[model samples]
Structure formats: C-alpha cells, structure tokens
Target chain A: MTTTNGLPPTGKSARIELVCPAGNLPSLRAAVDNGADSVYIGLRDNTNARNFGGLNFELPAARDGLDYAHRSGTKVLLAINTYPQPATWQRWTRAVDTAAGLGFDAVIIADAGLMRYAVRTHPQLRIHLSVQGSATSYEAINFYHRHFNVRRAVLPRVLSLAQVEQVIRNTPVEIEVFGFGSLCVMVEGRCALSSYVTGESPNMTGACSPAKAVRWEQKASGLEARLNGVLIDRYGANENAAYPTLCKGRFKAGDDVYYAIEEPASLNALELLPELDRIGVAAVKIEGRQRSPAYVAAVTRVWRQALDACAQGTAAPQPRWSEELRRMSEGQSHTLGAYHRPWK
Target chain B: MKLALGPLLYYWPRQSVVRFYEEIARSSVDIVYLGEVICSRRHELRLSDWLDLAAALEAAGKEVVLSTQALTESESDLRTLRRIAGNGRFPVEANDMGAVNVLAGAAPFIAGPHLNVYNPHTLSVLAGLGVRRWVMPVEMPRHVLEDMQHARPAGVETEVLAFGRLPLAFSARCFTARRNNLPKDDCRFSCIDHPDGLPLDTLEGAPFLVLNGIQTQSAHVHCLIADLDDLAGLGVDAVRISPQSRHTADVIALFRQRMIGALDAAAAARELEQLAPGATCDGYWRALPGMTPPGNAP
Candidate 1:
C-alpha cells in the first residue's frame, strides 16, 4: 500500500500549505518569521486546547497576531478546539465571535455545539474541524462538511498514509494533517486520561497534564515526576527527564512494566512531504503550542525548506535535517508515528 | 428514570455474552445496547450474531439498539457499522460520526457516550439529525447535565452512565496487547483473558486504571445507585449501567427498587459498594476530580 494517490490530480500545481503552532506572542511571530504559510494559535483560556501556564494569547495579543499574520501574508487559525462545559458554552461562543471580529482565517473546533455557535453566529467564518473532534473517516468528515459547512478537516494522527489518501479520494473537503511535534497516543477529543488524573483535558477543559498537578522531586536514587500524587516516572541519575503525561509514563502492566501506552517521543513527518503532496493534502500541521519560541522557530524553518524542495525537484537534505529536528523532539527522539504502522 | 444496559465493554466468550443477555432479557433493564464498541477485532459475536441476539432480547420485550465502534479507523469497521445502521429492526447508536452519516435523517438513532454532547446547541443539532437520546460522557459533572436539560430539544432524551468501570479513553495502540509484547495488528486476542479488564497500577502498587485492548477504564466502578434522587431531580431520562463481569443484574434490581421507592439512597449505596468490582466514586457528578468520591473536598 504505497502512496499511489487515487485522488483526482490536485492540479499538479497546488502548493501544499505549511501550518505551524504558536504558544505565545513570540512563538506566533517565530512561526510567521520562519516561513510558515499559516499559523494556528489558541486564546488564553480553556476555550483553546493548549491552555497551559503563562502560555496562549490574551485578547490584545490575539488582536496583534491577527494583524501581524495578515500583513505578513500568513493565515491565522484560532484553535477554540476544546469542548465547552454547559455553563461555559457562552464563553466559547464569545471566543468564536472574537475570532470572527478579529478576521481570523478559520476557527478550529472539536465540540459540535461550538461549531453550531460559530456557524450560526458568523456563517461566513471558515471552520476547520479539529483533529480533537475525532472524525477519522471520510464518512465522518463528510458528515461535518455537509451539516456544518466545514471548509477543511484536520486528520487525526491515528491514520496511516494509505488511509489518508483513501479518505482524500472520497471527500470533497480539504484535508490538513499533523506533520511534526508531540504525539497523542489516544484520539484527541475522545481521550480523558488527563482529566481522569488531573481534572483537566484537551477536550473538556483545554489542558492536558497541567503543570499545577505536576510535581518533580530529586530522590536519593533518581528524579521522580508525579501527577496529582500518582507517580508517572522515576529517572536514575544522569537519565534525561521527560514531562509526566499519563500516556507517556511508565507503568505496571501484566508481567512487564514499561511505557505501557507510549514512550516520551515526538512525531516528525518531514520524510513524507512529497507523498503527502501527491495525496492532495491541502496543509501539513506542526503540533506544539506548549513549546518555546525557539522550538517553534527551529521546527518551522526546517519543515519549510523540506516542503519547498518537493517543488524544486530536489531531494530533502539528509542527516543534518533529521539531527537538528531530533534535538527539538521529546526525549530527543522522533518517529513517523501512525503514518507507519510499525510504530503502533 | 428509564434504565439502559450499555453495550458490553468487555470481550466475553460467545456463550457468556449470549447467556448474559438472556438473563438481562428477563431482568429489569428497559433498553439493551448490543455491539462490539471497543475493538473491531473482538469476534466472539459477529454483527449478524448480535442482531440474532437483539432479536431474542427484543422478543422478550426489551428495547434494542446496536452500537457502533468508539474508534472506527478502518474501512472494515465502517462496513460493519453500515450493516448495524441498516439492520432495520431496531434503532442504532452512533458512537462515531461514520455511524452518524449512515443513520442521519433516516430513523432516530442514539448518540452514544463517546460523542461529545456537552452543550445545548450540540444537543439541538443532534436532535435535528434524529438523535432520540444522547449519553452523557462519564466525566461530565451533574450541573452541566442539568444546564443542558434545561434547554434540551423537544423529544430528546438524556442518558447518564450510572454504574460500572468508567471507560476513560481509547487509542489506536492496544495497551493489553503491548503489555504482552504483541504488535497491534498481530495481537492474539489477549483481551478475552480478563473478563473484567487488566488492572494497571502505579509504582507504589496503587490501582490506577484497567487496560481493555485499546480502551482504558477507571480502576473504580462509577456507582451512581445513591445519586438516583439527584438524577431524577435533574430530569435525567435514563441511567445506563455498563455490563460488568458480576452482579450486574443485582445492580439493575437495586436501581429498579430505588426508583420505585423500595430502597433509600444510603442503603443502596452500601449494597452497591459490595457488588462493585472496586471502590465507588461519583466525583464526576460533583464536578471535582473524577477519582475523588463526591462530597469530599478537593
């Protein structure tokens, strides 16, 4: 099942867009300055999935990014992707209104209610169904497209490249897929592992393994990281530390105790750029809004050149390109993730 | 409130599954949801076999609704879903949007717990698409359900997960298979061993979660036998008791008795704790962290 794209020729001319993430104002600028064709951002509240400490844009900062991205010829997509609580729906609706008022190019959303709000309130507002929404098939994606008039849908990380091309051939909607950054083992919106431990999640509260529930202490044997009093990991002296997320942590399962769900790693899909373009993928996304601006700059710059190479008919530069990205990955490692079935 | 038996989350032997439903058919359960909602590979019962079982249950005067998979990534999963949706005997529960696409604008189908229905607008939209009822995700708080109920669409029913180990999450990677060092595609149906689920503990030996193939469930069963009055007060239409390995019928009878004023909340709580697989918690209903039992201060 190689990438023999069955989708009608995407004109052999449509330049695939490079979408990047922004955690804060600086990161937003870093994405724009580093050749990102479009930048996705989240507001400074639970309305967005990346609501972490001292991160995300407040109203004024969002206004600035909106202006800056438009002036720089880079599109801005606001990620109000979290499911708003019943009492909290008003805030989410207001967030959509704010996005429309600020002239954001699109609003990435997961919750159906929020999509309804955005659609009814500002019908012209372009909507991109977030991967957090968990629409994994063309049937699912088409449901959203027909009902809500969604312009594009971000593919969940669970699909292989063959499955992706199969979906593209079936649906009229534009497809955006994750290219690089921290990987979620579970389907995005459907997961509640974070809230099950920390009372926070990307779906319900827009936070995952929040820092407040995180505690790190150096013991005699190793450094221990715990989330809400549950020990996630213990690292021996000289062992590099990784963030304590329930999915990434080591645990006792059957006779073997290991990183039972997934290891601390990031997803880098630069190697598949040409194949992704041939499959008619409209955009390739970078997935870290909880990262530093330097991290954003390093990843965005590398992917930008790789994407341009497909147009130049040049092979993507070798070991150096991968080594530079490895330095930015979680645990300094990268996998093509679900794109290649062996990672599963 | 109405009582529903959610689709069994475990992969029991075919005989066990058939016998379980045979007992449920004679029990007090009003709605019986049947299907392979967790992993598509669990083949003890095929879709036709499920429909055959559905016929037996429905013949015994029970409402039947077949449920789709929680994670429908493959084309085969969708094919099975289309068959279930087009079963034409009873309503179908749309667990994923693929199921929704097939069931929409035809017959009224259920919006299963995996669908995110936290707000009134999403509820209204689903109602328009012919959702007769929607299950509350296990982690939703009571107040959120109440708010949605206040503005719920007409003819729409609200169902809350009342009992059993709460399914916290699902993934493409199978933890149960991985625990045995088996690749996902080549997994040897290891989930059938643990009829309840494989319990995962922390380093200090505190039970945290249960691994059931690709699904992760709560270590403690979410017992809402004591919260019946609160549920009634909030106008909740149905309370679903997920199928566990043991004492499920007694759990159903207890809810039936409590609903008919035969039992009080305190006594029901005591009896339910003894029947549950582990400790009982209702922290999600109280809006605290899900692990903490309700009424305990955070």
Candidate 2:
C-alpha cells in the first residue's frame, strides 16, 4: 500500500507543522506568539462547526487576526466546515470567497458541493478537508483530492496509529492528526446524537450539545444534568461534575451504570510526536476553538516544545509537559485516543 | 408512500437471519436493503449469503440493495466495499464516500442516512453521481427536509426513516465489546446474544440508547406513520422501517395500512406504540430534542 508520493525520506528531515485553534483575536495572538505554524479560525456565523456564542471572528476581527498571524509568520486558515442549507448555500460560498480574497492561507471545507464551488470559483485557494468530511480511509481522502484538489486532509480521531500510517502511505494528500483537545467519541460530521437530543447538530447547525438545550438542576437526588429535559448524568454530592456532553455522560449498560460511551477525558498525543513525524504527517492539530486564550497559549507552548524535541531526537515523557497539559485538559486527564488500539 | 426495510444493524445467528428474511420475502415491503451496515466483523452473513437473500427477495418482487459498512478502516473492509460496489446485480446503498466513489459511474445507488446530506447542493452533487434516492439523516427536522425537497435535482427521490430505533452515531470502538470488557479485536462476537442490540439506560433507569457493536441507536423507535400525509405532501418517495428482532412484519403492515388511508394515524400510532420495543418519539421531526414527545414540541 506504500506510495512514494509525499513521504519524507527520513524522520529528521520532516518538519511537522503545529496547527492551533483561534476563536478570537487574543487566542490567535496567543497561538502565534507561542510558536504555532498555522492558526485555524471560524467566522461568527454557523458556517463553521464551532458556532458558539460570542466566539469566532467577525469580518473586521477576522481581517485583523489574519494580518496579525501573517505578520508573525503564522499561516491563517479559514474554517467553513459546516454543511450549507439550500437557502443559505450562498453564505458558505461567500465565506470561501471572503477567505480567498482576504489571503487566508487555506480554507478547510467538508461538504462536497462546497468543495466543488471552492475548486471551481477559487481554484487557487489551497483546500484542506476538514475532519467533518469523515474521510477515514485513504480511498475516501483520495476521492476528495481527485475531485477538489484538496492539499491536506485532517484525519478523524478514529484511526489507530498503524491505520493512519497506512493512509499516509497511500495518499499524496498531506495527513493531519489531532494532537490535543477535548475528544469526540463519535466520528466527526457523522454523529447525530446531539441532534437526537437537542435538534441542533454539528452537521446542520455547527454546534453539538448546544448550551441552550442543557439544564443543570440541583435535584434532591443529586446534581442532575439534563439535555432538553432528558437526563444525561447525575453526580453525587462528593463527586466532581463535568459538562454534559452526551457521550461522556454516565449511563447504565448491562449490570452497572457508568460512562458507557466514553469518559470525560481529553486526547493528548504529545507522546506520539516522534511516530507522527516519522509517518510523514504534514500537521498535528490542537482541537478547541472555544477555549480561553490562556488555554490556547499553554497548549500551543507545550506542543511546540514537544514537536521540537522530537525533531531533535531528544523526545521523552516530561513531567512538566504532562502536568501543564493536564491542567488545561477536560476533567484534568488525557488519553491517546484512537491513535492507540487499546483505547478503541 | 413506498416502504423499504433498512438493513439489519445487529449480528444475529445464521438461522435467525435466514428465517427473518425468508418471512420478509413475502411481506409488503417494496424495497429491501440487505448487507452488513454496522460492523465488518459480524460475519454471520457474508457477501455471498447476502446476495443469496437479495436474490430470494428479488424473486418475490422486491427491489434489493446491497449496503456498505459505515466505518471502513481495514484494507479488508475496503475490499468488501469494492466487491459490493461492483456486485452488478443489485443497486448499492453507499454508507460512506469511498463506496460512492467506486459506484459513481458504474451504476445508480442510494445514499444511505450516514452520508450527511443536510443541504440541497450536496444532494444535487450526489444526484449527479447517479444517486437515485437519498435517505434523510435521522436527526434532520421537517423544515430542513422541506427546503431540500423544494430544490432537489430532478429525478432524485427522497426517503425518510419512518420506523425503528434511530441510529444516532457510529464509532471505531465497539461499545458492545466495551460493555463486555473485551477489546474490539477480540470482541468474541458478543453482539450475537442480543438480536435488537443491548439497551443502555440512564443512571435513573430511563431507556436512552442501544449499543449495537460500533453503532449507537436511540432506544426509542422513530415512528412517522402519523406523518405519512406530511411526507406525501412534501413529495417524499419512500419510507424506511428498520428491522427489529420481533414484530417487524406487523410494523410494516401497519404503516402500509396507514399509508393507504385504511387506518387512522392515531389508531396506527397507538398500535405501533404497543408493538414497538420502547416508547416512540418524534422530537427531531418538530425541531426539538429527539427524546421529546411529538406533542411537547412548539
């Protein structure tokens, strides 16, 4: 399955790009100052997946952020990843036009029709397939590359290390894997769990488990978390409470009640830097465009150091790096996610 | 107004699967989607076995479709998908884009619900690739579908999920195996014991989701027999009813009766509630939480 398309000849020769998230102007600055090679941001509209309130860049802020990132030698990528409805398809195309016109480094897209528009109307804009595209296999990635001229494809956090290497070996498109962030148990773009509970989903609305649908009531039984009146989880008086993302909530399966789908943990693949670099992955992405600037700075700083150490062949588990990332991670814990087989 | 049976999402024993389809051969379903859409490891029925059943269903005047898996990771999985794409006998239901790529110009196919077609532009693109019909994603509300139906490409048909548990999500990790405390590689085919999938409930013991191998489905069945007139008004071509371990024939017959105006929607809904494995909900149809009752929505 090996192809000699874009593989780095040696591990040391590859310079794995560190891609960070920016939801606001300060976060964009934090990523750039902390040594991000590229910063991806979404617009204020629901055109992108992280359509949270008071987050994302308006037109003026986006222009400022783009100027700042480019001035600091950091590439700015526009994320117009959500599927555009019939009446609003023009909005998505306009977003692509805006990004290309404003000189954003690249535009990450998911929908096939939008990809066609990007390729046809703005052919020179470098296209990156967002994880929302759900192209888990190299064949799928190759389909997008062949049809849309996508330069890079962010692999979903579902493949094992060996499977990812297989995809990297097969496709000429650059592979980007998630390096650190809050984990999604379900495959991106394909999951309907949130919509089933709240009618808004990442595919249609660019939001999952929307805050408006969430209700945290101090019931007599315990601290109850409900999504649109359906019970998601309940914590005892002494137990710590976490945000009620549908997948991370505890549920009763078979003989016991527990976190049946997934635990409240973040994915930290800092330890896999050497392997990712060796695998010819063009980028390692940090997921969370809705966090504080401090969270962005801390994560970008740690990942930058780790990727550098791996390139110098001095990479090893450092207590300080792990401690810092743990503090910023969801639930103060992390897993290797699907990059490790046992996690599956 | 047409009824199509969705592909079975569970791994049943060989005899039960054969017996179930043998009965479906004589049922009133117009189209039958046949194959493994959940986990590739569920080898109770391989491609040949599915083809045999497809032939049997076709012999009884049913349109048969071979469905590909939702998550294709292994090289062997791709090989299976390629074979299905090239089957040539039956129309294929593509669950992922890889399947769509292989089947693009070869022949026409049906877009499975997992393909995530939320907009008319995406539907038109798939229609250009020879998609004759596109299944609506289960969680899409009626308003969105109305807009898509208005602008959908000519000759492209729309199908809605009418009955059975709504498949909410798919993951690489097998929750069924995880429930049994086993790794996915050596899952021991544990899903065979539960023909309808193992139910997962909230801590307070309310039915929530069903864990069927790698796929998670709503514990409540998504019945739209009451919305038959609305679907027809919107020009929907077909309605799909997912298979269950018990009472699938009765469920299909009820929907058929209601579709023909022989049975009232209220009476059909009442009967279906009794026959369904769990309570019924249509919140997603009304643009609210899926678990919300149809009457509770604004």
Q: Scoring each candidate complex against the real one, what DockQ results? A: 0.77, 0.76
Q: Write the per-residue lDDT of candidate 1 for residues A1-344, one digit (tens) a residue.
A: 33354345644235889999998889989999999999999888888888877888988999898888888999999998888877767898888999999899999999887887788889999999999899999999999998889989999898988888778878888999999899998888888888877777778888888889999999886898999988998898878899898889888865567887899999988888878888788999999988899999999999888888876767566677898999999988888888998776
Runs off by more than 4 Å, candidate 2: A1-13
**Which residue pairs in candidate 1 have backbone atoms (N, alpha carbon, C) closer than 3 angstroms, thus clashing?**
none
* lDDT of candidate 1 at residue A143, scale 0 to 100: 92
Q: Write the per-residue lDDT of candidate 2 for residues B66-146, one digit (tens) a residue.
A: 999999898888999999898878999999988888888789999999998988878888898899999998888899899
In terms of docking quality, model 2 is medium
- Model 1: lDDT of residue B223: 78
Chain A TM-score of each candidate structure, as shown: 0.95, 0.96
Name the lDDT value of residue B209 in candidate 2.
95
